[model samples]
Structures are given as C-alpha cells and as structure tokens.
Target: MRTLCSSTLIGEALLIMFAGLVAMKLTDVGTGTIWAVSGVAILLCVLLCGAITRPGAVWVGWALQLGVLASGLVLPTMYAFGVVFGALWWCSVHYGRKIDEFKAQRAAAEQAAPAAA
Candidate 1:
C-alpha cells in the first residue's frame, strides 16, 4: 500500500507542477498564486509518502486529487489529467492490497510447510 500510494503521489506531484506551469502561461492567475498552489501540492505529496501508514492519510490524498481537479478552472486540461490520475490512484490502492494479501498468504504457506515437515 505504501509503495503503490507513494509512487502514485510522486506521479501526481509532477502532473501538478506541469499544470501549474501551464496555468501560469495560459491563464490570468498570478504567478505567486500558481507557485503557492503548486508548492503546496508538491509538499503534500512528500508528506503523503511518509504518512501512508498513518490513519486518514487516504482522505488527504483524495482531497489533493480534488484540488488537482479544481485547478481545471484555471487550466481546462487539468480536468483530464485529474481524472486520469484519480483512476491510477484507485488502481494503486486496489492492486496494492491484493499484492499484500498474496504475499501474506505465501508467507503463511511457507510457515505451515515448515511446521508440517
């Protein structure tokens, strides 16, 4: 879960930066505002990497995703990017748990084999 979520967040951070640059170039939004928004999004991604094991971190991640989507108000392209990343986030959580489950099962089987031997 941590690995998957962290990887997804790293990707999201990059996308947010890209969107910020685009917004700065194409929109009337102030450079300072773009910088602040991008900075906060990137910072959240870093914090989320460490907080993956913490309670309610997933909710924070979802909020960040919504923030990314909201940026579409400034840069319409971000809506597509946000949706794509959101799906990726979902996949990361879903498949990551499945992988963890498989690993646990394998470990249990190994332990049971040795015990039976």
Candidate 2:
C-alpha cells in the first residue's frame, strides 16, 4: 500500500513535469516561474500522498484534481487530461479502501487457519 501510494505520486509528478515542459515549449507565455511553481506543487503532492497516512492525503489529491479541472477555464485544450485525472483520483480513493479491507480480511483468515490446525 505504501509503495502504491509512493509510486502514484512519482508517476503524477513526472507526468506533470512533462506537461509543464510541453506547455512552455508550445505557448507564447512560457513562464519559467509557472513551471517552478508546478514543480513545488508536484513535490507537495508526492509528500502528501506518499508520506501521509491520514485522510488528508485523499482530500489533498481531490483538491489537486479540482485544480486541474479549474485549469480548463484558462486552457480548454487540457480539459480531457484533467477529467481523466479526476476520474483516476476518484477510483484510487474508492477502490483503494476496498482493497485494503480485503487484504485485512485475508490476513485475518490466514492467521486464524494456523490456530485451528
């Protein structure tokens, strides 16, 4: 579970960094400052999702998704990416918990089997 969270953060950070580079290369307003800000946001996202164990990580992820959605107001072309990320965020929060529950139940059953033997 920890590895999953960390990998997710790393993957998102790489993707966001790539996007920032593309935006800078393609747009007239290629502000290095914007890319720097995004780097910080990506790092924070990594720390929040990977290092934190509380519900705060989930909330922060959702907020980032919302920020992605809001970006459409300024960059309509990127709306699809934001929508997909939001959907992924939703699934991660929803299904990830269910999987965790299943793992706990499986572990409990395994521990009980040895006692029964």
Q: Which candidate's lDDT is highest?
A: 1
Q: Report, for every candidate in turn, its global Cα lDDT versus the true structure.
A: 0.90, 0.70
TM-score of 1: 0.94
> Which one wins on TM-score?
1
Across 1-117, the per-residue lDDT of candidate 2 in tens digits comes to 444555566666776777777667766655776577677768777777655467577777777777766656545655887787777666666677788889999999999999999
TM-scores, all models, native as reference: 0.94, 0.80
